[model samples]
Each structure stands twice: as structure tokens, then as C-alpha cells.
Target chain A: MFEGREPIYQQIAEAIRGEILSGALNEGDQVMSTTQYASTYRINPATAAKAFAALESEGILRKQRGMGTFVSDGAPEQLRSSRRQSFFAERVDPLLRDADVLGIGADDLARYLLTSASDASSATNTDQNNA
Target chain B: MKANGTATIQGYGVQISDLAVRYGSTTALEGVNLDLAPGRIHGLLGRNGTGKTTLLSVLASLRQPHTGSVLVEGQAPFEHEVLMENICLIRESGDVIGDVSAADALDFVEVARPSFDREYADRLAHSFGLDLSVKPAAMSRGQRSALGATIGLASRAELTMFDEVHLGMDAPTRQKFYDELIADFAEHPRTFIISSHLISEIEPLVETVTILKNGTLLLSEEADDLRRRGVTLTGPTALVDQAAAAQTVLGHTVVGSRDLGPTRQLTLYGDLDQRSLDEAERAGLQVGPVPLQDLFIHLTDA
Candidate 1:
């Protein structure tokens, strides 16, 4: 379901950005029409249209007029870089704050992050070996 | 069916002014003014006996207003032949001929409604799993609701309203109806106003919202705009009071203190930017969004 704590339009924009970043929606590929999204998600058409307009403003999506909207050519890299910049503010700050609440120092938090990253990579390597 | 109308009529805008209705000594609606734009779904939200049905009934010409005026698609509706024909109102119950088969009832629509599309109706019936062979009175509650949805969607009138038409549907069936409504609206753009107490369920389905309380209009705005009306903060009473000092406090409710301090949660109605949210967070207060339903309940506090 597209329903969430955030506004539906913001959620819609994030979904499209996720798709673009993950390469599910390739560069220059046409996205669903507003009508299609509205019906598929059972959301208001204006909300869907609002999401599209936001993506267009961010240059992550472009319009083809009669053909409808499409993922922009530079959308993947654009989204990746933008997400990377906001990652610290939107994600890492909250993690650091939680660690601080638990009486963990910054160095200890950094150590924890390192170990978790290595553990994650090792798990992925094991899975690859199994495959 | 032979008809004397054009192929399609665009969606109609609804305008009402000083409209009032009374049932004997009781008032159902009073001095209500609303403007519903064409080609968008408007959610008419209210508690029971809030005049939602009374307003829709008047628009559909089921009854005349005791005072004032109503204009549908820019023309008066009372006894206005063609204009009345263009409006369809589907109720929660008792709109159908109970003794007739569902198919017969739909057939009746074909003859009575100049714009009825038989194939579309049949397709909708199949989609809804409607057993058209059974009489309306014999059908289950859910099936009757499905029939109501079928007619509401397939009618294709210029202005179609559903007054809690999703009442008896199960979750999946209601989702199906919502999807069908958006799809049908896309395929044939028209004005639709759905009245329901299920605010969250209908929130995403509507672009415009009209909330009623005690037979009067409370607030009417775009659904998105309405959702952005408030942010609720819960913390120490002094801190909460300080944070909400300049804002419009919709209401405040007492909450448990964190550590022997008097804590009160207050909901403020109106816009608050991200900086304000951050300020609340910095002040150690928990910030939460006020959903449309909560806003409606507060705005229509009774």
C-alpha cells in the first residue's frame, strides 16, 4: 500500500526516486500515466499529478507531452548524488542521536558502523559463494 | 435505447448558497454554501445526522430546499428536465426495487437513464461478481453494495454521487471499488462526490473535501491541503505552551508526564514548516502528524 506517515504525494515521489535509483525504471523509460498510478494505488488523481510535477521539477522525470512522463536521462545519477548528500542529514544524524542516548561515544558508534558494514559484506560474499 | 442527448456531457461544477432543509420541527441542513469543482472527486465527510445525505438528496432533486438555491452544472436542478437527468445519486440502502432481479433493475436503468451503457454495466457487474439473476431483496448485504457500486460506476452521468456506497463491502472489495472508481473516472471524467464516515478510507480517493458538522459546513479544501493543517506536539506543559504560544491551538489534551512534570499535548491547526518541526524536536517534544480524520474530528468538535 502507498499509504504511509508522510503525505501520499511525497511518498509517490520517493517511490519513483527509489525506482530510478535502483534501476528498476531505467533512464529515458516512460513512467506510468497519472491515471494509471491513481487507479493502481487507489489514490486521488491530483495527488498522483502532484507527485509527477515534483519529480519533473527535480529533473528526475521529464514530460513527453502526448506520450506522458518518463525517467530523465540523468535521473539515476542525479537521484543517487542527491540521496547521498541527504543521507547524513536524513539518516546518519538520527542513528548517531540514538547511539548517544544509549551512552555510546562517537568513536564507539564509528566502530559499530565499521563492524556492521564488514559483517554485511561478508554475508553477501557467503551468499555469492553459495550461489 | 433511443435518446435525444449529445454523446457526452462534461463534468459539472456544483454551487449552493443559503440552502436549508427541515424535517417537520427538526433541521437537517442550514445555510450551507459549497462549491464543488468539476472532474474531481469530492469527499463529503460528516458524522451521522450531519446533513451529508440531506445535501446530496437536494442536489439529486430527491427533495427541494426549504430556502435558497442550488445550481448543478450551472443550471437549476428542481424540475429542470435535462439537468436532473444528468445527476445520479447512489445511496447506502433502499434505492433499488427490492422485488426485481438485479438484471431487471439494470435494464430499468437503460430505459430510464439516457446515458446508460449496457455493456459497461454488464462488465462492471462481472467485475464486482454481482449475481444479476437474483432479486435485489434476496441478495446478501455485500452483494447489494456491489450492485450499488456497479450502477454508480456504469451510470456515466455528468455528476454521480455515492453516499456511503462502500458501506457493506469487505476490505478487498472496497479496494476493488476504489480502483474501479479511479479507472472509470479516468476513462470518463465526471464530477463525483462521495459521502462517508470512513475518513481514511475515502481520504486518498478524493481531491477535495467538505466536512460538515451540525448541519453546517465546517471546512472545505483540497484533501492534500487539509492534511497539512496541523502538527501535534506532546511534552511538558510549559514547553508545549511555549512552542504553541503563537500558533492556533485547535485543542489540547492532558497526557502522562515523563518525570512528574505536567505534560500536555496540543494540536495546532494550520501550516508548520520543517524548521518548526525541528524546533519542536530540539525542544524535546514529540512531534506527530494530525491525519485528516483527526483534523475533521477536532474541527467539527461537538
Candidate 2:
């Protein structure tokens, strides 16, 4: 669902990018048409089309003459690299700054992250063992 | 029922060229020009008595322009039966005749509008939780509005318009109507103009937004572009002022401030570059968005 902030089209583009990078959508997979996206999400078709156009410009999606839009061959890789570049600025940097304000050092955060990761793997292992 | 009749206007493009309407000395609309493409939902937004109804009435051929003209599907829609038949305009009361039951009113559309489909009307009515057996006079305002919505949608004219069609419906009902409209439009695909004071209610549903101010065309643009006309910047007063100094600030206020530091939120109108936004963000300022309603109010304020 789209919130009204920062234009819905931009969010749509970001969402498609996320989907491609997360492997939910594979390269060469036919994505939803603009109208289909609009109907499914209940957003304006124009907004949906604008997002698709943006994706096309970024070489993420391609539109065939008769057929619908398909994820470009290098879409997932392209998105991954682009997202990787921004991940530090948009996500990691903010978290690090917030932790700094809370008087949490980088080493402490790293230690916490290690503990969280071990806990997650152990939880998965327990599920597998139970199964 | 003019079934085997004349022209069937296939396209739903609307062109209002210098459309001006007046009721005697009182000027209703002046030199209003708008170009609405085929099969797009347009939101006609305006303040009270800002000629929203006048524009729609002119398009519906309910009242002719005293000075200008309106073209739907490349021809003027005056007494042109073919064009008129292809256009359905439902006003705020949902256009249901008071004397008849909702079912009868819908059935009447089937007789009058060659494009009206009874099964579709029934389905929409059921989805809207409307009882077809209830007369418009006896039905609640919400039910009547739902019936009107059902009729307007089921008619499926090449150009179907609803003027404040959500009149007395609750928030959830209006939302349901919008959802239904989106689903139906995807399947049918026609030009739909919805006039409403509730800009946010219809903003997401529309592709194009035509705003009227004091009976004149203020601005018309795609809703996607129109919604970006304003941006909100929130930060410390000094930094916010420095960043917003060169921009056109429509409104600004101090949302949070201490004796030592004052944090301000500035609503800026017009285009802004990404570089400026990045600079502001780097200065520890949070960039936000102006809601459609706020923008409309700001743009239309005297």
C-alpha cells in the first residue's frame, strides 16, 4: 500500500527495486502491467505507469510491443549494486548514528549483532531439529 | 431505449475550450480550458461555488456554456443524442430520483442509457450493501449515495462523471466506493471525472487533477505531479530558514522548540532540486511532504 508522502510513484519504483533485489522477482519474469499494479494496489494507474517508466529508464524493466513489462536481464544485479551503494547512507549510517547518540560504541553494536545472528541461527537449527 | 440508434461515441476524451458559463449577471466560470485524455480518472477540485459543478454540468450538457464550448469525443454535446447517451453525470445526491426505489431507478438507467447493464448494477449494489428495494425517499443518505454510485458505475458510459457522489457516506463506505470504482475502471476503462471537496478522498483515485479557484482554472496537471507541488522541511529554525530562504515558503510553523533551540516545519511550494534537499538532509533536517488537502487549501487560499 502507498502512503501519500514523497509521491506514490517513487515508492512504487523503490518497491519494485526491493522486490527484484530480494529475489522475489527473478530476471526475465514478467512483472505486472501498470494497470494490473494499479488495480492490485488500488493506486492510480498513472502513478503506476510513471513508476514503470522510471524503472524502464533505470534498465530495470522493459516493455515489449505486444506483451507486457518484463524484468530486464540484469535487473536484479543492477538493483543489488544500486541498493548496496545506498544501504550504508540510508540504513546503516542512520542506525550507527542513533547508536552513537545512545552511547553505544561500534564494538558493542557489533557484539550485539553477533549475538543476534547466533540466536537466529540457533532458532533455525532448533526448528530443523524438531522437524 | 435508443438501442439500434445512431452514433456510439467510443472514445471518452474531453476538451473544454475557453468554457465560460454564467447565470445572468453572476459569472459561474470564466475562460476555463481543460484537456482530459481518454480513459483516465480526473479529480475536479475546487472550493465552494468555485465552478466545479458548472464545469461538470457543462460537460454533462445539463446546461450549455453561455460563451464557450465543450467537446466530448471530438463533438459538442448539446442536443447530440449520441454523445449525450454516452455521457453519464451523477450529482451529489447520486442522481437517484426520489420517488422510485433504487432498483427502479437503476432499471430506468438501463432503459435510458443504452450502455447500462442491469447485472453489473445489481452486483455493485450488493457490494455497496445497498438494498435495491428501498426507495430513494425512504433510504438513508448513505444508501441513496451508494445507489447513485451503483447507477453511475453500471451505466459505464464512455464518459462517466460523479459530482461529490460520496455525499453522506461514512469514511468506510466512501472507501469501498472508491475501491469498487478502481476495480470496475480497470475492467471497463473509460474517462471518469469525480468532483469533490474531499481532495484526499479522491486524490489517489485520479490520474489528472483540475483545480478551480474563484470560477477560473487555477491549475491542471497529472495528480502524480500535482501532489509534488509542495514539500515540507523540518529542522532547527536557523538551518531551516537558511535552507528555505531561497525557496517559496507557503507556510511555516514551530512544531517543537526550546528556549535554546527552536525547531520549525516549513511547507514550501513549487519545484525543488534534489541537491538542495540532500544539503538540507545533511544539515540534520528531515524532509517531509505536504498532504494533498493542505496543498489544495494553500493553493486556493485567498
Q: All models: lDDT?
A: 0.82, 0.82
- Pairs clashing in candidate 1? none
Docking verdict class for candidate 1: acceptable
Report the lDDT tens digits of candidate 1 across residue range B113-157. Answer: 787788988998898888899998998777888888888888788
What is the C-alpha lDDT profile of model 2 across B1-302, one tens digit per residue?
Answer: 32233553334899888888999999999999889998789889999999998888988889999887789988999999988988999888677788888878887889989888899899888988888888899988888888889888988889999998889988988988888888778766778999998887787788888899999999999876766666777877888888876453534332222333487777777776656777787657787777788888878886
Superposed model 1: Cα runs more than 4 Å off: A1-6, A65-68, A111-131, B1-10, B234-267, B271-274, B281-286
lDDT at B228, model 2: 66
Candidate 2 residue pairs in backbone clash: none
Off by over 4 Å in 2: A24-36, A56-74, A89-131, B1-11, B246-261
